[model samples]
Target: MSTTNQFQQAAHYARVIAAIARDRPVPPATLSSLHVIANQLDNAANFLDTDAPGPLSSLPIAATEALWLAELFAEDNPATRLPTDFTNYVLHRITGRPLPFPEPMFPLSDRLALQEVELTNRLQYLHDDTDMQVAHPDEWLRAVLSLWQKLLRLAEAVREDNSRSSHQ
Candidate 1:
């Protein structure tokens, strides 16, 4: 897609997310759409120029917004926690060991995109070091594929829930 088109699409999704945030009981279908949009934002960041007011600027905001909406959905049901199994696995696989989590100095926000942020940071870390990239190509690929699969599964789950609700 053209850069302008990507921007327009991202803006449209942002508006939709904002509208849903204004009301209660945000629908699973919308969240599913948000997940897809978030992926697109990530993809756009990959191929687009890192210009000001562009995909690079928009991506983190979009990620934050999508994560916030997903948290809203999870709040209604304790069972609907954010997906972490694949995140943890990818983290371990990339780092070659389980990472230790130190206590946060400040309280964490519900809107925090914990998994996405951590994984992206790790991926960036791997990408920056030529030696690491060459030495662990499989790990890097696995992390990328695993993250995409996790995102797809999350979107599919929301879609499945939406279908089930409509049928009921």
Candidate 2:
């Protein structure tokens, strides 16, 4: 995939995260689009790393976990779907998981704006670093896997919270 597409995908991811952070209702279409993008990323990873294609694979594993989490979050019952931002806040307030983003004290618009900027900046850094990845296939693999890992961790945190809430 081209770098432009990657940049757009990064923006899309940021928008989704921003919506989640604001606790705004994410449309079904948005979730579906995200699922598609996640699959594409997985495909790209698989194409790059063919030697280790199994359950024990490295990069593909992270992408697969992210894809599954995306599917789970896309379930019909929105109430059961937890947003990572909210999950982080709950964990921070109750369980001591650090809040990595800015405090959500501002108005909704302001918060969303700030989050979009922050996420975009981070993604830009990742994108700029991809120049090295181009020269080293291993670096590319690591970069993709790292991005997926970060995203998956957020999703996993939310999933865990959902499970805990359900049992209570």
Candidate 3:
């Protein structure tokens, strides 16, 4: 894919995160992370469009994870599908078990957005409720973080794959 296309994919990932954010309410942590990704994407796209001097490596890192995550969680989602090798990496990150095939991400804009909101609200309550607080949703948040990391792996893997293949 063209560099432009890669950046566009990053935008697409950000859009999905934004969709998730709009779900209910975003936790401060997840909200901050999403905001950072959004800002990074916005800045990266502009720089990339201008033919900036930096390597293409920087832009793809944060965007790859959720695309793969969609394959795992939102399989019915038509918007994002993970490449096979990338899918394997994501499966390893999210679950120890291996996957059989790639799946499409089912688009759940409102549902995801609300889920973030609810999670954030619940997280806040958990933080405040000294008497009734439950455990922080570390696994839940970790899942999201893991998905986000998928892009970074793919980005590096692409560079490494090219380097190795070019030696032939």
Question: TM-scores across all candidates?
Answer: 0.24, 0.25, 0.25
lDDT per residue (tens digit) for residues 1-168 in model 3: 444554444344334433443342445654544444344334433443443223534433333344433333333321232233323322232233442221322223444444445444453443344243113223333334344344333444444554664434
- The whole-model lDDT of each prediction reads 0.39, 0.39, 0.38
Backbone atom clashes (below 3 Å) for every candidate: 0, 0, 14
lDDT of 3 at 148: 39
Residue pairs in collision within model 1: none
Instruction: Tell me the deviation in Å of residue 150 in model 1.
Output: 3.0
Q: What's every prediction's RMSD, in angstroms? A: 14.9, 16.4, 19.6
TM-score of 2: 0.25
Greater lDDT among 2 and 3 belongs to 2
lDDT of 2 by residue, 8-61 (tens): 333343233433323323476655554543454344334323423344323334
Off by over 4 Å in 1: 1-112, 151-168
